[model samples]
Target: MTVKLTNIRIITCHGEEVIEKGEVLFNEKGILDVGQRVNTDEHEIQEIDGSGLTVLPGLIDSHVHLGMDSSPDPFANMKNEGPEDIAFKAVQQGYRFLQSGITSVRNLGTRYNVDISYRNAVSVGTVVGPRVFAAGSPIVMTGGHGHVMAIEADGCDEVRKAARSQIKAGADLLKVMATGGVLTEGNDPGATQFSEEELRCICQEANKASKTTAAHTIGTDGIKNAIRAGVTTIEHAYLLDEEAVELMLKKGTFLVPTLLAPRLILDKPGAVPEYMIDKVRKIIADHKISFQLAHQAGVPIAAGTDAGTPFNTPGLLSDELALMVEYGMTNHEAIYSATLGAAKAIQKETEIGSIENGKAADLIVVSGNPLENIRCLDSLVYVFSKGAIVHHAPVNKQEKQEQIV
Candidate 1:
């Protein structure tokens, strides 16, 4: 199917200039052309009138867990649920994300490869959802954070073997638990879980398999170790010290702060554990400072909400953008973090990050200008993924009449 979206304002991160009145042409396979205007009447394409809307590349969420729920004991819930049940829930989450104008998502962790199965299903047209880069299961040390749902391995040799196993299982990326987490009980959030040598070995194995590694590190030491070991992205560097931040900037590592994950806990105190609530309350106070430091130090920051965590919804990633703006990021920078920066973090920049001529036809049309008010992202009227419209907000009859007249 061919589609022509005309009379739209296009925002591309490649240049400072914006196309005030532009058109995008796409077929079923991918985007065919994008310019200020294109000859479309001869092509027998379905023309979509975009009179007053702004069109941008589809949003990407760099960190997500597709098959997990935010229960009081999320790991215990995962253990009890069968794979079939998990797969169904994952598909549901994927669809929800698509509806919210997110064309692609990187699943940071999942139970038993359920996210991988869901990704395959979406690729094969068996399901209707956003594009997914799945990490089958995160590698963690024995009794470490996320160990309940992760593959537990000890030492460098075991870590290397475990990482290779994930690659063989069709993981797009390898996730490693490099430090203790807030959600997991009986673990210190400030402690490191994987040794520096073990992290290096895991990265080496992942590189051999041509897979990227994302380290889930929160504490200062773990953050430094993950950066030194060459992990592509740091999931949550909540307790990053000056040394760690400097190393990250020097190494050009991408940081997906996942600010919403901790902020959610603080905002809705009743949703998470009391201990986590208190921990997050303290962390939230300092998170903005850390983010500002990372920004000032030239560290690449991407927006990731850590969706599927307690109080974090799949379709509401715009909240993360709002938080980014709160942390000294301009509206345009925050939007770019969710789009281009996120794609770069996940290594999918060539395919779906921008509204380019040869990229996938993954775009969103919002009713208002997002540049003026970032929250206008929530006013999505149309969303397209791979040239397919997955979500279309119904236009009010009165508004339709006004447009017609």
Candidate 2:
């Protein structure tokens, strides 16, 4: 199938310029051309009129959990469900994300290696979903944060073996619980869960398997340890200090702030426990300073909402972009973080990040300019993934009546 999109405003994220009247051409394999104009034989192509729409590369979410339920105690809920149930929920979430204009997502953690199976299903056209890069069951310490659904191991040797096991199970990436978390009861969010030696062992094992590592770190000490050990990305650096920020910049570590998690737990009081709410509030207050410091120090940042959490849905990733703007990023910068910056973190820069020639035709068209009002992303007119239209809003009744008359 060949598609010709013309007369649209395009933001390529290739440079600092926006093309007001641009054209894009795509075939069954990938994008063929993207520029100001390209002549095509009308008889052999399907034309899509984009007279007053803005087109952008499909957004990518770097941090997400597909198997999570919509309850506050999702971990407990997962424990009761079987692998088949989990797979069904994961496919549903994946389609929801696609409808929201997100063409790809990284699954940070899952139980029974369900993400790998689901990824294969999508690749073979048996399922309708986004491109998935999954991390099979995360590595955690016994009784540590995320232990409910993670593979719990202690000591350097045990951690290394666990990492190898995950790799053998077809994990695209390795996830380690480097620090405590808020959602799990009896775990202090300010404590480090893994020693430096253990972290280094996990990283080394993952490296041997030719896979990247993402550390779930929040405290300052844990953040420093993960950065020094050469992990690829840091998730939720809530208590980041000046030294940690500097080390991150020096080591060229990318940060996935997951700004929505803190805000969701704080702003919506009833979604979480009272004790959890207080902790989240305190963390949010402290996060403002560290987040601003990271921004001022030139640390690389990516937009990840940690979706599937309570009050954080898959289709609401645009809220993360708004939070970035509130934290001193321009609208274009926020959008770029969600697109090109995220692709860079996942090591997929050449494939699906931007509206460039010879790339996958994963794109979204909106009725208004998101560059001016970022909220316009919510009103998607059409969504195309891999040269196929996945979502299209129906024309209104008034317009249909006028056309009939």
By lDDT, who's the top model here?
2
User: What digit string (tens of lDDT, one per residue) describes model 1 on residues 9-65?
Assistant: 888765454687789888768888888887655557888888777788899999999
- Where model 1 places Cα greater than 4 Å from the true spot, the runs are 40-42, 396-405
Clashing pairs in 2: none
Q: lDDT tens string, model 2, 21-99?
A: 8899987688888889977675678887776678899999989888887566677788887889889999999999999
Task: List residue ranges in candidate 2 displaced over 4 A.
Answer: 394-405
Q: Which pairs clash (backbone N, Cα, C closer than 3 Å) in model 1? A: none
lDDT of 2 at 190: 81
What lDDT does candidate 1 reach at residue 369?
Answer: 70
